[model samples]
Target: MIHKQVVNHRQIAWLVGSLLMTGMMISFLRSVVQVARMDAWFSQILPIFYALFIAYVLSGLVEAYPGKNIFEILFIIGGKWIGGAINLLILFYIWIILAIDIKGAADFLHISLLPTTPLEVILLVFVLLMMYYGKTSLEVAARVNEFYFPLYFIMCISLYFLLVNEYNVERLEPILTSSLDRIVVSNFLPVGVYGDIFLIGAFLHAIVEPRLFFAAMKHGVIIVGFGTTIMLLVLLGVMGFMIASRLNFPIYILVQQIHVTDFLDRVEMILFSVWFPAFTIKVIVAYLAFLVGVGTFGGQRHYNTFNAPCGWFIVVSSIFGFPNVAHIDQFISYSLPLIVLVFQLPLAIFLLIHVRRKNKGREQSLIPEGTKLYRFYRSMVWITTVCLSGCVIVILIGDFFKDKSAVGGIATAIVFIALLLIALLTSYGEMQALNHGKQKLGRAKQAGSFRQ
Candidate 1:
């Protein structure tokens, strides 16, 4: 058996922070600007809320199942057939995300820094570095994140100051005037970017301070949220939405505009160097998740053994996945949000229900009849049921009235109802079990008093 390694909360925070910052810093913001126009920054807010909810749900799973990662938790809740299917789906999603990141990085390098170099060579070198990191333990990855966090922070700050003179406050004027349809569509665009935080589910068990996991995750996400928000503001304010939308890599273009003096031009080269490690961290995390999923599905104790093959697979897929960068941008804007939500939202709801049921079972065993704590626990269950039911209703109603894509909306509504039903049944069963336990305890206490 491979020995598990534990990393502190700070390391976890840095890992998540780096992943989010790197993802946002790439070409993602252009999609948001495309939809929301000057109000692009508003689109980011919804996804932050979505990300926090996911973090909360995943954290509940961690607390319920102590040291189990998402794969183990899935098996426990879903059993073999259902859990295995979900696991495979998640692995496929991770593989695609990994491939995209690899391809994106290679494309960026080829376009900007290594224009003369062959794309294959650029991809090969990057993949080798990624495989080297992936072959090592996740602890090493965490440490790399820790080391890069400060440098990433400094570079972001420097970039902001460098571009300060170019910002036009008027460009961000007339913010909320965007059409409701466009705003709603834009709101969903960044879902995939923020949903990347869900990758933390894989590393939950490795957190040394499990009790602090949620807090650390929240902190990390806030860091990402603020950083991305700032970068978006800078991009919009500096280049305006039209130009920013047209640029292939808006942030890189914004960096290219940094001309402090004749000598200080071309600072983007230095910024790119600083940014490379952060991008690598994202690739590493995605690759690591892919490896973990493979190990979990295959029941292999030594996941690292598959590293070379998987890394090469990513290399080949990255090269052949899309004909060009335009395809990638199209996928990110139109396809990725729905794909990410399809995988993440349903799984989160399932895990949340599963963890709540398990916790209620443990409470039933421990708590005495008529105790305040037990009563409070039961009340909480009712509250949860009401909240979840309300969410399902709202989603169904919204889908029926507002969503333009009828099939997508209907599919989402169906998923919501299925999750709601599962939660209700679990809650009802736990209530029954709790009531029985209370009755048994009551009778025992009465018998003891009578005998005395």
Candidate 2:
């Protein structure tokens, strides 16, 4: 039997992070700004955690089917027809994403890089290159992403420092200017952007260290989430929410504003060198994912066998699939998150029910259930999170609730976050202690068996 290549945890984490950074950074801003207004930066936090929670919860499927990708697991647990139907629905989801992003990136380039060039020409070139790269396996893509992701990450982070002079703290003022309900509901868009985390399900089988999947996602979520929050923060500080929200691509404009030294006026192109790869790599990863789903569906050994057709289909659909960038933005803002949740929650519940039934008598625990100590630590973590969340909310929106100002609310929020971090660290320490104990017990059992 031919063996599939495996990717380590770090590779999976960085690959997923790079994939998410593209969409969130590129075109995810306008909707959130419109809805959340000045508080758009704050709006990012909840959706990020939401994505991580969903990824962690659905990972039960990975533990249940230790040797299979999501596609394979669905085939086994969902049965042939059910699995086939679900996979097909996934293909549709992937197609819409590919179509929208491919078009969005193309439009961005046509507007930014090659204003004189025809948009269709740009689209054709981008699609051909993506198709060529998509032919490569996930292992190859992960390696390339790992090698260059650091440079991309460093350049992005450096933006905060470079644009420090442009920052106006006052712009972020009147904290929580948007209505609480609107801001909460506005989360659906950025959260929809974070919903790309769901795509990680496709590649779980490629993970060489199955035990480290959650750790990998944690790393990915932190990088993507932190990066996005900073981007929104910088934009708000630089241009204020009013200007930041009105623009089609605020990030692009933000980059253009960087006047490095007197001689170097527009280094946007230099950053484009960084941003282009960041943008295209996500599309490339999506392409690879699409091929995986299709390969399983059509039973092809070489995923590229259908690459041309799929590539062209995406290209044509992209051109006509979205009327304009506005439509894409609106869909991402309003529609996509719901679509992702509708598909994901049901599928997870369906798989969960089936997994419990099939593994009724089997060892359902992967590592171990929460011991009493572990549960206690876990409760502390939850309490700390709630406290921190309350502090931030009270500081921002407490004006509506009380007559007196929420004095020192920011300081209170900072203190709560520090405590939350301690809670998390202690919880991790307890987990390690528990794991060591379990390992010793397992070794003792093995020794007894061998003696017999």
Candidate 3:
């Protein structure tokens, strides 16, 4: 068995966030934009929900059976024959994906950077890196993710923030114009990308505190999910869905417009430098997970033993797997979602069926509505309600000012802003009233005690 690594919750969370950044920009963005159009930003909601639920369920299962990962759980719960079959299936899935990731990274680097360098050369270098990663401990891999995620995060955010000038809010003007069926379909499109978080099941054994594994996974996923949501919006907000959807990598082209100063013109390379590592780390994590799973399943050989052989195998398969960019793109765009669901649904059902059920009420009581997470969501809920209400009011009252002139537009803007402010003030007033009431009750109780 591979040694347990002392990785903290925060560090692993960063790994999850880092793993997601590259995939979102390169692959996940354009596909959703094509289907959802203006509403593509909200498509992240489905995957986020699904991913978190999977995390919660998987973690709960991990906690129930201490020290054992889901793969091992399959064996214990089902015994060798049946469990081994399922285990092999999951391993097979991971191996296919790991190979695909290696190829995808090579393809990306070849097209974006070392065009003069042969593809096989790039593939060789990448496979060697994965071989090194596979041979290393989980702690080492986590540290690499820790370092790269922030650099990737800052580069993407800074470049996008600078593009505020280019963002035409009108590009996102007509919301939910797409049919209901289209919106639901678009939501499922990104599931394949996000469902990779299920690989967290492989990561459970490495965590220093396995109990908090789900918490770290959830936080990490939230960062990715929200970040991805904002990224899609920005892509649509700056470049209309028409333009955003057409490009294979909208974010790359989007960053090309980042000519901050005369000297800093064409700094997409800077962003690319950060993003390349970001993408590579994602592959490393997936590769490492596969290796770790392999190590545990055998109980005899070290995971590192397979790393070189498997890495070379992947190198060859990757070259063949992605015959061209279009082939991989088609596979990812269409085939991937089905594969994700096939793996995800069965695993989830199996865990839910077999996992040790903890005290439901006790668990619910632990995270009261007053907690930071719940409060933040409550505040967001209120804000969304107020904004949506304001929009509806504007639409309803907007008919009165039928002149589609500058005056009418200004009036609509003013009305929307006014209603939004009023709603916010009312919510604020309610909060103050509740606080005042609590303070008054405290004083009254003090006086009553003093008299006694």
Per-model CA lDDT versus the true structure: 0.71, 0.69, 0.68
In model 2, the number of clashes is 0
* Candidate 1, superposed: residue stretches over 4 Å from native: 208-211, 361-452
Clash counts for the predictions, in order: 0, 0, 0
Model 3 lDDT tens row, 214-254 = 55665676567656766776788889999988886688888
Compared with the true structure, what per-residue lDDT tens digits does model 1 show for residues 1-452?
A: 12375776667667877877786676878988988887675465457567767877876777687777787678777899988888888887887787778888788888978899999999899889988887776788888778787688678756668887887767875444556677678878888877788777776667533334654565566566556666776788898999988888999889888988886668888878878887798888888878887878778756887889998988998778875888887887778888878878887877778777866755324245466645754674565446454543544354355445545544443444454444334443443444444455567687763110
The count of residue-pair clashes in candidate 3 stands at: 0
TM-score of each: 0.78, 0.84, 0.79
Rate residue 308 of model 1 by lDDT.
Answer: 91
Residue pairs with backbone overlap in model 1:
none
Reference-based lDDT, residue 74, model 2: 78
Scored by TM-score, the top model is: 2
